[model samples]
Target: MNHPLYGYSLCAALALMLFFGIYFLTARTPDKPIFSNYLRSRRIMGVALLVLAANYLVHLLCELRFSHPDQAIFLNLSTYYLSAWLFSSALTSLLDRNYLCRNRFLRHILGWLLFTGVSAVVLLLMPAGIPQFIGLLIMAIWFFVYAFRLARRLVRTYRKAVRIVDDFHSDHIAAYIRWLSIFTYWAVVYGVGCGVLTFLPKRYVFLWVLSSIPFYIYLFCSYMNYLLFYEQVERILESEMECKPDTNLPDSEDTAPIGHLTIPPKLTLWLNGHGFTQPGLTIEELAEELGTNRTYLADYIKTTYHTSFREWITMLRLEYAKSMLVKHPEQTVSWISEASGFLSQSHFTRIFTEKESCTPARWRKLKD
Candidate 1:
């Protein structure tokens, strides 16, 4: 191996693995179910990153053992093991966030066994360069199929979450899932490129290998940035949860019948009378204040406003925000965002733009 580029690539992979490992260790445990999934997905991705680094290390060892026939055989076996392990780890991390799957653990285990078995068989049977192409082809097919399924499930999940809360919690989780799906899709594409390059002429193979190093390094950095963004969103969620008071209610309320409860007109009066302007206000809190079960209140909002509790609250906030913008043009967007019960300016801006077909600034300017 005359390629100095290989050494630099290996070093870069190792460095990224170390950084992600530290981040995985330091990341706080999530308090909510959505964030719990996020943390779990990140943990799995970290394991995948470590496996990738190990594969690179094994490749380095294989290169060093070229002169020693006996050692080369052993290193070659190690390379095969690491390669199969890397593929399995990557697939697991990519699919672990598919919350819509039932019996996920069993499915994941079966997938791991099947893929690993296929990879090992191909590596053992085919000529060295040929197996990579076949393996990557299989990987690419599986990734696209799985990613499509995951994307569909994520859309359904997001719709449900939107009905539950209009806040960033659901949106954050959906964004995380979308990013993971895209990452998996691109990862397979990269693997396919690497496999294709393996069939190139021996002289060109060196260049192919050299080029792959920076791509892997770039992937590692991108994932690290994604994790950092995920962590920041988690912190925002934690603060939002902390600010809201816990309402002790029966677990059965989740499935309780809300058809019998009479929703007083006072409920609307209370919401519009500056009650909806409280930051981080949740359905349960509003239900408690209304002296009704949370399910009943949710149903009431759904029936009366033809929207979910979250949507109703969001609408109220938007109306309040519009009035504030018209009356107090001097207030900054950030100030108005908070004053209108939004958790962050970004969230406010996103919703406002979606509803108004323009950004908050543009909408305000038009209204003025």
Candidate 2:
């Protein structure tokens, strides 16, 4: 093969296929109802990986055989088909969360698939130069625009979902979506570059194939990262559901009489009594401690406090840290962070800055 890395590329494709095949087969049965979207997304990713692998294998075989003109045409058609299929799968997975009404979401997915199918057919019938390039350019532009919009929506959905589940953080989900958007943008750029390369001399074709190898490696790695991330999120959700709240407590020495507070008296008592300052405190755990279900507790926090459980907890921790800084001016930020029940000083500083409009150190300095 003219492409020096052809064999290595095929091997990588095979490895990707094997890995996703195993993942698809061995994906754990979701223990909770909320993981349905997660499972569905994983299945979609598996299918996309499978198609991508097959596309690479076919390209390798075509190059090795020095395919006939008719075979080359068929290969071009197959490439468009597989690329469109994979793109559709990726977009569908991004929108698969319960963010939209089920009927509306399904309709949108169906429409996308139908449009991609038709575009692939049209591209297959078009001649192999300017016409194909135009079709690819249009599709690439559409994908980039749609992926950008979907990424934003996914971030919002992640934030709303995290409000009810303590272990779920919007950071990971946002990062994943951000990476996916970046990958999609680069994929379109590469597709356009390759289309332009086709118009050049035959010798430049090898360079095009070489450039594509990196993208294939990136795609493989990204898919693997996504799979691992899905598993991690699922594990956290399951553990959160199964964990029992820490209920053993010593009797209060001086019960602070509850004044007329809009917040639930029990919840307020728990917060002032230092329950909110406990490390790794989840809404579910707090709910169990207060003799309520997770949903009711989440609703109570949202409706009564006009904030999510996470923000409310952070508020409590921030107040505690402020008091500590005032009382113990000798304490380091790390010590204060630990004492305030934050996971790390960096996290503590980030929350403090977001809420206080200054870094922890600056806040402390101003206080002094």
Candidate 3:
């Protein structure tokens, strides 16, 4: 692969592996309810990514050949609308909760409609040929807007899931939120660059090379850092949770309020029991399983564990995911995420990076 194109191909490969990893894991497990829905969404998104990759590759390959540039390029440009449509579908899947069994006809129409709307806006404002460089810039802007909006929704959903008084994991929940924030900022920066590139002359277009290199380098370094420090810890923690003593309870402050001291033995059993089976259990549902009220549970979590229930569940999930990744190397991170309890591959990616400080791909690579 050519050097410049190779960089993107690497991303494409990573995305592809991520898709299948989730698929294999989901197929093998066949029981994670929460993750089942996410699996459907991710499959949709993954196909879209493949579409985007193919479109980009076609354009790049045609450009390098410099033969029938106009015709080849025109063919490539046609895919842009399709690529954008796919991208919109992918984003919509990410934003939606419980996408499995969703109305396929509705989804297809939504994606196509979104693509048409965006294309119409672009057409009305710009001339033909549209400058490949400038077009990329516009697309980046679209990406950033969607990324930030999605981040906000995730944060809100997570917070809503947390309880104030229960024993919960803080690090894992915080990590999820932080990762989303970082990605949001990343999107903003990419958008800013796109805006900047709009005015640059053709000769100075190579400046994009200089700008993008640093961003990619940062992403690579972040991946490395996450694998070394956090990924290892999360794996260990997950294993402990999976096999956690069903009867033995972690010590909490006895002097703690009724909410705090209310740690039910049945809940421990429930946690361990489900640890063996359930995929994608939420804190609210978990609280219900324990026969506790959500608000009281929140107070118990806040007073006894000094964290929210959401955080605690995330910690449990991460701990389990990490263990699965290490114990079942053949299994993809997506499988572990489903088995451990996450909403989607995007959610899993954000949390894993936040908690483990590395992408699942980087973590697996390190173990290899």
Candidate 4:
């Protein structure tokens, strides 16, 4: 507690929590499926985040509680934090059930025991060496056994559904999900790093805390890229893909670049140029730029690409934004939104929530 970095670290942690709370609560629409499904699970995860926030707040209180001998407040808060941490395993299990890893009642119970009990026991047993090490070990095992399978399923879905993109509304949902995978990886790395740093003494705390700065930078850059891409989407339409006024027909599988599929030269070249200039293009704008009506563009996108224009653009924007957010956390969300070519902050916020499954601000803060 005597460490000079303690205050800075505590403040940073608080900022992270506040940022996430605001982003999650405000980002999504009431009708969104992501906001609906797994309500219990969402609450559980939210509790965990809140508890962690409380834990940090308690740490600050502890530093100020010397005058009151009856001050058990911080201690109780710590208990709640740990308890919530334990419950988080079950929540995670439930979340996974919707994805590649099917969750059975038995498996969830066992996972809870392993994550909360066995893991805790191991940490207490080897206080200095085993906590983060064991955490990392368990995470590695979990990924290979459970998370990896889920990822494979997603990839399979992405590849198999290429033709169904236009007809399927699920493609947009899936696309948002795909981009989150990148954050998931970063979360694991940061979680492990944070745990390791926890065992260090006061003086060295800055070194440990400062480790997260790079992650913040990643956040900023990724958001900027997303903003830029969306802004250019409209202007670059015809160059990116061809449109026909005919029935949603099966696409030609020509020999062309892997990213572009067998797309027409006009469309392929536009995409290759990293989207049309303007830096603020969107689906509507792209349609206007191509002189292709929205109905035509939507039809072509649905039939040829097997997805909606919004979904397609969202997927592209979200991925680019995620990369920018990860790389440039210093930038504000407003900056990121503008750079991404969003019409307004509200639009960016809404679309980001609908498409990415999380707010841009929250996603970036979680990386911390």
Q: lDDT winner among the candidates?
A: 2
Residue 78 error for model 1, in Å? 12
Q: Could you tell me how far off, in angstroms, the CA of residue 79 lies in candidate 1 after the best superposition?
A: 9.6
lDDT of 2 at 90: 50
Model 2 poorest ten-residue lDDT run? 253-262
Q: What is the lDDT of residue 91 in candidate 2?
A: 43
What TM-score does candidate 2 reach? 0.59
Estimate TM-scores for all models. 0.62, 0.59, 0.41, 0.39
Q: Candidate 4: misplaced stretches above 4 Å?
A: 22-28, 31-35, 38-45, 54-106, 123-178, 195-202, 207-368
Which numbered prediction scores highest in TM-score against the true structure? Answer: 1
Q: Cα RMSD to native, each candidate?
A: 7.1, 8.5, 13.9, 14.7
Which residue runs of candidate 3 sit more than 4 Å off their true CA positions? 1-38, 64-96, 99-151, 158-178, 204-295, 299-368
lDDT of 1 by residue, 1-368 (tens): 56565556556656766676567646675475545655665565566556556655765666643344233333333343344333334434333344425576467557656655565555445565766656656754654465445445544543443333444321223454354445445655655566466556544545544554565555556555665455544453454445445455344654434432445765767856888888766666776777776556666666667865566778889989998998999999999999988888999999999999998889889988
**If both were scored by TM-score, which would come out higher, candidate 2 or candidate 3?**
2
Whichever of 3 and 4 has more TM-score, that candidate is 3
Q: Could you give the candidate ranking by lDDT, starting with the highest? A: 2, 1, 3, 4
Error of 1 at 161 (Å): 5.5
Native-vs-model 3 lDDT? 0.50
Model 3 residue 1 CA deviation (Å) reads 14
lDDT of 4: 0.48
Candidate 2 C-alpha lDDT tens digits along 208-290: 55676676567557755665456545455455445435344223533211221323777768877877667766665676778
